[model samples]
Target: MIYVVEDDKSIRNLIEYALSEKSYQVKTFADGLDIVDVVRENAPELIILDIMLPGKDGIEILNEIREFSDIPIILLTARTDEFDKVMGLESGADDYITKPFSVLELLSRVKAILRRSAKKDTDHINYNNISLNTKKRTVKVDGKLIDLTYKEFEMLLFLMNNIGNVITREDFLLKIWGYDYEGETRTVDVHIASLRSKLLDAGKLIKTVRNLGYKFGEI
Candidate 1:
């Protein structure tokens, strides 16, 4: 099932109708007030969220959802500012669509995100006492479970998978956030910093490459 949270009744109905026409089960919400609790109870396959809401904004709701689940979220916004887009992407939104968007485009994005999420990697990666089980989507450092946000996990997995090689911020955006993403490269830095912090001492393995990017390996 899919969930759409939009304050505008017209837009909400439009989205609901469009998604339903595609044979997708959809639930609609007027605001983000009860989304977290509803998601906690029964997470949907994906969420279409409007950035400007009555109660909690989409970014706040995105952060709260990321705290527990990584359910794919596509943000909807009337604003065309870069700040809102960057903030949404940095806060864990899978994608975002500006207002006055085509329903066809929205459906396409929804389909693409759902398709990507369905694809899974079954490999297990271990490096420098950090254990990652891709199939299980779990990470352990020094034999203890470590909590990682969805982006953090993906960033770590990408780094570990390319040990001894330097990975640029642009590479990260293209690889983890998708090639079409237009957010600032600084988003990569923020996630890396948070990831390193959560990994504790093992964080040292992720070394900065001076003028280039980052490298994950023994220094």
Candidate 2:
């Protein structure tokens, strides 16, 4: 199921109609008032959200949703400003489409994100004292379970998968955030710091290359 959160009646109905034609189960919302709660109770496969709304705005809603779920979200914005786009992505939107976008293009983006989201890795990864179960989406350090956010988990898994290789921030944003954009390298740094902290002594396995990116395993 997909959730469409757009205040504009015409746009909301249009999205609902297009998604319905694709055989997608959709629920439309004129505002983000109850979206967080609804998502907690019955999370949808994806969400098409507008940045400008009557209350709580889309960014706030995005943050709230990211707290417990990494459900794919596509931001619907009429703003052409790069700041809004970057902010939305940093806040955990999988993708964004500007207003007056082609319905076909929107449908294509939806299908692509869904396809990526459906992928599952059933292998277990063990690096040093860290154990990760991709299929279970759980991480343990030194035999103690440690909680990690979605991005942190993915980042750690990717680094461990490529141990000893330098991974650039741009590569992380592309592979993890699912987008290629500038001025968001700090986002990677922030998540890396948090992940390192959560891993305790095992965190030392993540090495920082002064002028490059980050590498996992040994100094």
Candidate 3:
């Protein structure tokens, strides 16, 4: 299910119409407060949120939802200011669309976010002696808990989720980091190294793929 929070009725209708035409299940709420519970109850595949709304704004709602879920978020930015974009990214939004965005652009972003999330859930990929409790964003190895940053855990999960398949650094930047982060390839390598080192007993589960990048090996 796809949920949208937009105060503008016409714009909301347009988004609902466009995505629904493509056979996507869509629900819209005029205020963030109206549909906040829907997130917990329905678990949307993707969320389209407007930056300005009645009662609770997008940023507040984003923070609220993030307290409990990592559902992919696409912020409908109200301005072209770079700061707003940066703030939104820092707030855990998966993508952003500036005001007056074309329907084609919105559809493109929706497709990319959905595809990236789909790759993540392809299979139940767990580390040896380590498990990714999606509900908790945690990793445990040998019954000892390991601490990992949000992106660190995501990168580890992405590689492990793909198992033997080699995932390129570019894919990680685009999928896990967002396209706006500007070429953090080296960062991906660094995080993988750190996560592996911490895994200790289960470290062998992560493997370097020569020039390709990294992969998760089976136990």
Candidate 4:
């Protein structure tokens, strides 16, 4: 189950149509106030939250939900300020997308985040032909060892841990780089590109979303 909160009728309907086409059960709300009770009564597996909403804003609703549940949430906003992105993530959003984003991207992010949230942690994670040994801090493709840099190893580990999640550049900076690491998000892109190249045949598993960050598993 998924809940989409957006005041824009066309966008809301479009989102609903996209998710429905993918065989997901969806509920749409035009106002933040209109969905609070429903969220409390029937907790959805995931939420597509729009920042600008009538009555109560998405941030306010997010705060309210955080007080009760830690369900995965993906924010939608028109703001491109880094401060706003950081604030949204700090406020408990698992992911976010800027406005005028591709419906394909949104749907991809939705599926990826849900897959990530549903995953259980284990010392060994194997997907396709790639294997990640968290306990040993090693990665192998087809039983052959693959050497990675300190940062690359950590990055791959993080991605493997989250699996199909859509991790924004902000998320990479906050998780891999220290939250206060005073560097541009481009550093993440560089590292990701390097990691992908090193991963060889398995590199294709790391997908890049235009204007967004990357998802670390097959969609």
Candidate 5:
């Protein structure tokens, strides 16, 4: 699902109509608060956030959402501040788009990211106590269900899909976080920890190499 939070009803309708033409499940909101609750309850795959929201700005929404979930966010803003864009990217936005943009260009970017992310999941993954249904965005451990945030699921799937290989922190920040963000490698480590903690006590399956990277080994 693509949740769009734009104040302008005309723009929102245009985007919704265009995306719907491609058969995508699209939801539109006039304000961040209008759909902020839905983000927690039923997280969409991607969010189109507007920076200059009425009550709560897009940056705040990104921060609030990042506190719990890591849904892929695409920031749409009128301000062309480099520092603000950097802040948005660092605050967990997967992509940033400036206002008065081309809908086709936006559509292409969204599709590309989602397609690449989807392709990354189905490549290779093997586990004894865990199972992931990539298409459904669901996970199972030891034949039981497990709950994971969007980022957690993506992080886990990325590791499992590349088991036995060492993935560097820089690579993770570039690919998963959507840029070579100016954050410490420890952020990746923290995400790995968060992903590992949810799996059924098999956190050690994700191996850490000192001064190197991470490797996922089947348990």
Candidate 6:
């Protein structure tokens, strides 16, 4: 299911019409208040949020939702400023689209995100004594559970998915932080450090490739 949260009636109706026509189950909202309750009842697969709303703006709602859910979110707003986009991504949005967007473009992005998420739904990765359940988003090493933040879990998942292969910091920034992310490579280093600390003995599986990048699964 998809949730569309926009204050404008016409825009909400148009988005609903377009998505419903494509056979997607959708629900529309005119404010942020009701969404909090609705999500508690049943969370949608993806959310389309408008930055400008009656109150509690989109960023606030996005941050609140990230507290318990990692559901994909696409920000739809008229704010074309680079700072707004960066802030939205930093706030946990999976993608961003400025106002006056094409419905076709929106639909395509929705499909792509859902498709990628679905591909990762059922698969589990295991190497030596470490186990990662993608669907449950759980990690365990030597029969001990590890608590990881969203980004930390994703960073570890990406590396384990391509065991024995080197991945550059630039690639990590693009894939994990979104293509538009303006953050430096240092962000990757920081997250990797945290992830390694949590992984305990399994952390040694990840190795620095000497000016190239990072590689997982032994040297």
lDDT string, candidate 5, 1-219, tens digits: 899999989888988998899889998999987566677556676888989999999999988877655557889888988998999999989889897889898899889868765666463233645667777777765445688988788888888878889888887877688877987889988988888888857677898978988888843
Model 3 misplacement above 4 A: 123-219
Clashing pairs for predicted structure model 5, backbone only: none
Superposition error at 33 for model 5 (Å): 1.2
Which of 2 and 6 is ahead in lDDT? 2
Give lDDT tens digits, candidate 4, residues 1-219. Answer: 899999999999999999999999999999898676676555688999999998999999998877555568999999988988898999999999999899899989998998887763346666665667777888876556889998898888778778778888888888877676787889999999999998897899899988888888778
Better of 3 and 5 by lDDT: 3
TM-scores for candidates 1 onward, in order: 0.58, 0.58, 0.58, 0.54, 0.56, 0.58
The sequence of per-residue lDDT tens digits that candidate 2 reaches over residues 1-219 is 999999999999999999999999999999999988887656678999999999779999999877656778999999999999999999989999999899999999999998887763235666555668888889876447899999999999999899899999888999998877676588888888999999998888889888778999875
In candidate 2, stretches whose alpha carbon ends up further than 4 angstroms from where it belongs are 120-219
lDDT of 2: 0.88
- What number of backbone clashes does candidate 2 have, counting pairs of residues 3 or more apart or in separate chains? 0
* lDDT of each residue in 51-85, candidate 3, tens digit only: 98888889888887776566789999778889988
lDDT of 5 at 70: 50
Off by over 4 Å in 5: 119-219
- The alpha-carbon lDDT assigned to residue 29 of candidate 1 equals 97
Question: Where does candidate 3 clash, by residue pair?
Answer: none
Clashes (backbone N, CA, C under 3 Å), per candidate, total 0, 0, 0, 0, 0, 0
Query: In model 3, where is the ten-residue run with the lowest total lDDT?
Result: 121-130
lDDT of 1 by residue, 166-217 (tens): 9999899989988857877888889999999999998988999887789998
